[model samples]
Target: MIGILGFVAVFAGGRWLGWAARWVWLLAWGWLLVLLLAHAPYMPPELGAFVGGEFRGWFVLGVLAALALAYRTGLRRLQGRVAPVVAEARPGAFSAVELDRYARHILLREIGGPGQKRLKAAKVLVVGAGGLGSPALLYLAASGVGVIGVIDGDAVEGSNLQRQIIHTDARIGMPKVFSADVAMKALNPFIEVRPYHRQLEEGFAAELVAEYDLVLDGTDNFDTRYLVNRVCAAAGKPLISAAITQWEGQISLYDPTHGGPCFECVFPVRPAPGMVPTCAEAGVAAPLPGVIGAMMAMEAVKHLTGAGQGLRGRLMIHDALYAETRVIGVKRRAGCAACGGG
Candidate 1:
């Protein structure tokens, strides 16, 4: 009994002192080994008596402990493999868990309970899952936006891991939309995530944009950007668009329906091919997207909850190389192709 108690005490003390589990196990095993040696034929009888346990009994205890540890490890692995199901909150009300989770936002003067409730009721669509979209989507989900739709046709690549922080190396081959969906759900399961693993087509662009309250464009190419802008303009949905290149990025809220310049109004003519290089050709800084993407999410939150001023009618340019930021006012163009000075 004394030997068993001593072994337990040593193991518990080591663990309580924040020792590594392997070290604690080693200490316990060393204690048992000492007891076994004390019981050896060559040891003094008084030592064996003092150790207070038969060798076989101590060995059985060690086997039981190993089995228990193995069982716990396997159980934990199984639990990790299982997907957790979070309960859905009733419409127009927050559950206890949600209330606690958003207590900080609720306590804020701007985004109080009513603002948070608006966030919970809002729906947003993200046009890409790359650098800018990664942080934008993550923050939107973390902010408890009710429903988020992400659309992308590309697969996660090793090259994207640097700027696209939402994707992991293990998900390199996964579709960007699905990867973003997984990350968003993992961050906050209370929100609904709709992943479209296909390019946004002109056929469904208008229909899709109409489904969400707002749109965020983070695509790299010009064709898709123009298509998204056109569809968003036709649907009268506000678009928060951002673009990042080597050491620089820009974001704006384009909503001609709300007295703001649409994307085409600000830049009517598409840059000549090869004149403006993509990130693949230009090589952007790693943290630049996070900065701009987080700002995009912040603007979206502000737009949805009416917490503060939004980026409507203004373009924010961030020059990471020089650590400078500038906001320039934009206006609706009279003969804009997408949104004609409405």
Candidate 2:
């Protein structure tokens, strides 16, 4: 009740002060931080202990409860309030069972308990349930990444069973996202899988990508890839893009952590009409996206866990026909356009 009254007083004062308080959002966040710190364990020993031994206990509990309620209420009342930032979902302390189950990953110096925690807290949205999307979804879910969202509007056909490994004969007619969700759940029930069985467009893509920590472009078309890039750029979400054509494939990370080039920076815009042939028209080799898709998944895991150097600012190209690979360095444009000056 005290916390509530204090917040009410501040809000009223802010309103009376008019435009001096530019944003109530910041005011709410500021008050929330103050409340958390006041309820922290830094009080004197007598005030920190439970019972009368700690003047801090009841006060802390009451203030925390009040702050939490106020924070939620203010968010619902504010404009442009986003989902609460969930601490970046990095790894931290672990239970014995998690240690045993993830012994290999935990044993690695790069991805100790903290890194695994981050991975477990990550929410990734895979944009396609087809070729590249299939492998990325499976690997990310199996890796114990906490939440995975699969978005696709297509239905499974008999032909998709070859590369889209998540779908089965029994799920041949099911929506690809729903089918993949079931398979992923079966693989690791511990992970939360959100399946979206609808086509993504401009506004909806913005909203969907905004909710996730990162996005993976498993899509195969120029139009969808452009759409995904625009959405991720606007929403400030990292994006991993992979494409397969004939016997060749490429993977790139449009991550902003390095302040490097985004997918838009590299591709700029879609090629002129007929400038590039579609995989459907040109006939992609069956194993092409599988090999590249798995790599894309690995990059995502590495990124989520901060395990090692990611593909940020670098594009990887592979040609299975000739068994050759190439790496191209990418740089964020100073004034080229798109995300640069935005």
Candidate 3:
């Protein structure tokens, strides 16, 4: 019992004091050899002869095992010292676990380690945890964006289960922001999720837009969409806004600060009353939001990482029923209202 306790203490201390790691196995094996040599004298005549003959073999085996342990322990300690130096040399260095998690992204020449680092350093605010917000938030979190803020005043309902994929049926009646927060955090434990369980009002929209590097407007209503657009434009932050209704969806990045058209450049005036119907009133296809929202997430990734050409001055329109996709060039309307004349 004393020997066992002594062995445990030595092993723990050796591992803790890394400089003593290589000698631990040597000491342990030497102690075992001593015990065997001491006990050999008291054994029976036959046993004594057998022990004398086997001593050389046992000694050789112990030495070999001790050498192997020494090599392994020394290498581990060396690696432990070198890892921090390597991490310090590279900006935004990732841990072994993080590198493995984002291995696929790192492999992409377009979005390699530098791009992944940018994704990790980005801050994106997504307005409305509804249809378009669902997939956008999910993919953003999965992509490793460092911080994601989700704002919504509504709660999950039985009717929302059709298009809002982030909210599970069990989460019905829960605040949409909280549901989204749970989903995003579950998808990527590395990212931060901020849930604003309130509506996006003009009084706070400007301040909120200024806080984020980018804004994604997935709100279902025209009022909030225009509000987000104006605030993002005023703050010079890029905005990725997408809308889905019935069978079609539209998405674009509005950044007049960088010469891209703002949201109001294309739609200077809201449609005449009753000209356009809400998704709730007109009914959207289940997959329409999924398609548009995923695209919105993709655009956000591109914008943050500078990986590929973004939808800067172009609008992407997808018609699910017709199986058609089109891109239209939109220019900033100079001398007009909203983002113009600034």
How do all models score by TM-score?
0.77, 0.70, 0.73
TM-score of 1: 0.77
| Steric overlap count per candidate | 0, 6, 0
* Candidate 3 residue-wise lDDT, 1-342, digit = tens: 344454676788788888465498677766566545734656566653443435555567567877987898899999987744221112366778678878999999999999999998888999999999999999998898888999999999999999899999999999999999888877777788889999999988888878899999998788998899888888889999998889999999999999888999889989887888899899999999999999999999899888889999999999999999999998888775788734
Task: Write one digit per residue (lDDT tens) for candidate 1, span 13-39.
Answer: 997899998898788888888888888
Top candidate by TM-score: 1
Report the CA-based lDDT of candidate 3 relative to the real structure: 0.85
| Pairs in clash, predicted candidate 2 | 89-118, 90-117, 90-118, 91-114, 91-117, 91-118
Alpha-carbon lDDT of model 1: 0.92
Model 3 poorest ten-residue lDDT run:
83-92
Q: Whole-model Cα lDDT per candidate?
A: 0.92, 0.79, 0.85
1 against 2, candidate with superior TM-score? 1
In model 3, where do residues sit more than 4 Å from their true spots? Answer: 1-91
How many residue pairs clash in model 2?
Answer: 6
On TM-score, the stronger of 2 and 3 is 3
